[model samples]
Target: MTADIAADILVIGAGIAGASLAAELAPHARVVLIEAEDMPGYHSTGRSAAFWHETLGGPLVQPLTRASYPVLEAGGFLKPRASLEVAEINGLPLLDKLASEFAGTGVGLARLDHDGIRQWVPRARPILVGGMLESTGADIDVAGLHGSVLAAFRRAGGMLETGRRIDRVERIDGVWHVQAGDWHTSAPIIVNAAGAWADGLAAMAGAKPLGIQPMRRTIAQVRVTTDDVPDHLPLVIDIAGSYYFRPEGPNRLWLCPHDETPVEAGDAAPEEIDVAIAIDRFETVTDWKVAAVERKWAGLRSFAPDRLPVYGFDPVVDGFFWFAGQGGIGIQTAPAAAMLGAALLLGQPMPDAVAAIDPAPYAPDRFVALAQR
Candidate 1:
């Protein structure tokens, strides 16, 4: 109950990826998860929009959704929440392209005329909308899903050390000696899952830096007319992804601009300009005006240069593994991401289902390959 002191596999972050990997690896190995904050998921994972749309991720990451669906379905982490993306006059071409890509992923969508937009979100103005409605997207049980992984990890003999903000790491006798405050932990296998802080950790481990940048994304909540907006309304968005708003309660809606501004890793805060942009866009698309802001916050969504998640062990380091650069798909793809980690750590054959998709596109070495040019 005090501290793990050490583990065979040491995970450096306590967000979705780290937590899920810890849960998956705990049953087979001695696993210890370390969090800089007093609680897990204090950053991006805690501030997610909690959507589970398989068609939204990159081509390389689509298979992760396919692989993770079984666990999500079995774990009851998803519930159908009707959703649509509206393309305005300026967004028609992009909307068409997105719809084509979505269709390729086996996601059912309808090319909605202005009238169709009003049918879904009643407040939506028909005159300026032309978009596609992705009929199969769902809302996620974020807290439940994240909690389940933590619960499973603990139940499987994994150790969790919270507020153990790591200060230093050094290779002594080819073993990593990690220091958090005065306490020390040594592990042969160290997973770089510190989310926004991943690059810093990699630097400490003497690994080459990957151009991982943490971007601040903000969200705000506003009151909606109860009778006009149903509690089960689909998540409505701009076809260009400039803004999105979804039902939070019978009379409340959550909204955010798809803003991505680079920032240092820490507790992200919502900006007034970002909030104004979302409200302005919401008013432009729908007749509803955001007169009151109930709440507002922000989170860091880190991304690699290619915008794909970096997985697999570092080529130069013997025991260091990369599991960062998840961007915004961390929760939806956690199951497969953790399984991928497990396979690499155990030095076992990749699961046939996952291997069929080929993980090389997302490997850490891909960055190395790009730099050679």
Candidate 2:
């Protein structure tokens, strides 16, 4: 084979990160997006409980989330849905620390008493002492957003190769030669946006693995046999990160035990124990009775040792770039993250949306720098 296909850059993984970055880079460069699954976002992006909230991604990540909101909202990928982190009387201290931590971050966190909690998440048990309300949160249309970005990539003449998992990656002279299910391609540069398989891809590209660990998270959708799962309910999360539940429909809610069980990278599936645990946690916070489990799922969220996204070229490998370790906030932070990635990769000035963000913190070289110290 002549390795007939060629592009300026080859992006591995067609999830939100790859699709978004490919879309951003395509107009400026010929890009090839390769996916292991038959469809883009068959993993994390599609399995996301899909919510965009300023406070969800931590302080370092908040900037990306803040910058992405405007783009998602303007694109109509966001729908109004607030978030609440509630605590029992014993856990009130956690909420206190949370309020003080986000004091001037521009994330509007309102202190809510029991009555206030009930006002938002109606029919709540009195055991809940207080909560913090981030009223600006919204539901993200993950599929719509991913599709739009992929469509934009196609419109920019980017080639998308699905059902082809990269099996071989080797750098010859100044080019990267990749083989995925018999489809051979070459590019001057290769971007590792492989999500759960990011570390494995890095190793294959002759770049140092950045300790990207894939952890499993489970979600279960259940129909409530109460006065209806209130459509007005906010995205309810426990202050201590034990559980979270959000209204999926008028009579159903999606619940999670907030589990982060570490596991190998592969096709993740919901454990029966996790589904039972989710329902158990749901009952403690509300009076709603779960009539049945309509559905359940699990997805892998990969993260770096420091738990921030890695975006930049490899320090040791000349032609390898990393755009992984986004954790659960990848979809929520896609727009800004992609803009930042494109600017860094293309050696162009940062766009106005993320110009103020200091990208050094999320760079791959941070690990190399850490070793020196």
Candidate 3:
């Protein structure tokens, strides 16, 4: 049997974006959040590496990351795990460029000599010793952050429904009538936060399409004895990002090739070839051996053509909003992104920085611009 519900704000996906926005909007409006899976965050959100990094991307995304850092720090969502980048001797040039580009963003990394590197990770291979950059990076508590948002939404009288796959959508009398299987729902504003399925969800709502694609990123776990490894060592990434390894538990390390393979929506599995490539890359840069394997998994990182997040209303659709295509930075940038989303939904003025950086660049309208010309 299908149920019917009405709300002032209807959020289609319950990942970081939808959940956070629901929490933010619930205070001022009746909010409803629905997740297709039996639970929220069952896809990309569940598979995140959970790190607070500000200087990892281009200049455009830096402010959002910086703006988000304060909240994460204040709310106790971050742990000072620190971060480092090491490469073979030939990789020094790229490492230097990275440091120069991101110097002012508070990462404050410096080149480490061979002796300095030894002080951090003694097991690092000497022959591959190009140099390293050590910075005060934070380890994020993803579950705690997401849960906090959920709790906030619930306390504000927000409603959430799970396992409701939206099958159809229609606008009637200037309101959205949505059907998820037999259940019918209505809302004055419908937010499309469907992650990898954002574009498809927009189409279902009769809104202008945004070209969003889902890219798969695979990660693996390798077992090692902790006797020789320093407990305080930061996460070590390759200069080229060919692969990276960070201490996980007392006796294991988490590794990834940082691959980006395009895929369809759903739970993603690690490719054997990707694992093999990661193993080769990890072994090449570090002294660690891949003798024992603890486990492995993969998740999809959705992206727009421009690789920036798409937020704001569909220029062609009255109340349909776009809030997907976060790539892999959803967890880190959710605070600011969700604020911008709620602002757009409520027809309120955006923050000065958000206004300065025109949301049109990342809007669903860009797809129409491409076709218009």
- Taking all chains together, each candidate's TM-score versus the true structure is 0.95, 0.98, 0.91
Write one digit per residue (lDDT tens) for candidate 1, span 1-373. Answer: 1233767889999999999999989988888898999989999898998787766665678889778878888998989887787887888997878766656666677888888777788777764568677777788888889999999999999989899999888877767788888778888889999999999999999998798999999999988544467766788877677888898776778889999999998899999999999888888878876658899999999999999999889989778999999998999899898888788778877776566667788899987778899
Go through the candidates in order and give each one's C-alpha lDDT: 0.85, 0.92, 0.81
Model 2 lDDT per residue over 245-307, tens place: 999877889999998889999999999999999998889878888999999999999989999
Looking at model 3, how many pairs of residues clash? 0
Find the 10 residues in a row with the least total lDDT in model 1. 1-10
Candidate 3 lDDT (Cα, 0 to 1): 0.81
As a whole number from 0 to 100, the lDDT of residue 343 in candidate 2 is 97
Q: Where does candidate 3 clash, by residue pair? A: none
- Candidate 3 stretches with Cα past 4 Å from truth are 1-3, 113-115, 127-134, 351-361, 366-373
- What is the Å distance of residue 350 in model 2 from its true position? 0.2
Comparing 2 and 3 by TM-score, which wins?
Answer: 2
Write the residue-wise lDDT of candidate 3 on 1-373 in tens digits.
1228888989999988899989989998998998999989988888888777766655667677767777788889998876777777788897788777877766667788667777777777675565555565788899889999999999999999999998888888878988877888898799999999998988888875667899889888887644455677788777776777788776677889989898888789999899889888877666767767778899889998888888888888888988999998889888877777787788788865455545565667777777799
In terms of lDDT, the best-performing candidate is 2
**Model 3 lDDT at residue 230:** 64
Worst 10 residues of 2 by lDDT: 223-232
